[model samples]
Target: MSTVVAQTEEPEFDLVEAALALCGGDAHATITALLDELRFVRGQLALSEAGMSVGFTRGWKPRFEIEGDT
Candidate 1:
């Protein structure tokens, strides 16, 4: 019997494809830079229609809402 190796799964960011498209196949400048670009791309997405429902949309709000308005 032979052993199999596992591979990593892709990120779940719906707008990731857009960021990659913006990159246009350029070599990643840096890990931080790539993340920065992605963040910018995410913000752009939030401005677009249905963007909030896409993948993961970040919103500023209080942590852990109080139930029953208590």
Candidate 2:
């Protein structure tokens, strides 16, 4: 039996490398920065959801609602 191997092409720009370069190659710093940005985005989403009118949203609700969240 013969098996065929698949090869993947590398991207022109590496996002992981770019992120490391921006954080001076500190892995911890890169992770912390990403987490902070995620928190900020989630907060913004929550605010937007809170402001949305039930009528405007047509009674639509988030599929997953976290406990203790308004």
Candidate 3:
């Protein structure tokens, strides 16, 4: 009888560890930076959606609309 064995490979580098290293091992700073980047990306997406014509977008509505933005 033959037995099957499973092998798992680990990543060469950890992305979270790399980010912490880039932030000088400061977890708070890394989280803050990530949140800032997320906000910037969301703002850019909102702007792009706003600039698109209704006809071009096929009446698609943005999911991130803020109150008083319409």
The candidate maximizing TM-score is: 2
**Per-prediction count of colliding residue pairs?**
0, 0, 0
Cα lDDT of model 3 by residue, 3-55, tens digit: 99898997698889998998999999999999998899899988988799889
Q: List the residue pairs that clash in candidate 3.
A: none
Candidate 2 structure, TM-score to reference: 0.60
18 in model 1: Cα distance from truth in Å? 18
Pick out the ten consecutive residues of candidate 1 with the lowest summed lDDT: 57-66
lDDT of 1 by residue, 1-70 (tens): 9999999998787665665566674547444568786788766655663544434545533223346865
What C-alpha root-mean-square deviation, in Å, does candidate 2 show against the real structure?
7.3
Clashing pairs in 1: none
TM-score, every prediction:
0.30, 0.60, 0.58
CA displacement after TM-score superposition, residue 38 of candidate 1 (Å): 0.3
Candidate 2 per-residue lDDT over residues 1-70, each given as its tens digit: 9999899997699999999999999999999999898788788878878889889899985433477857
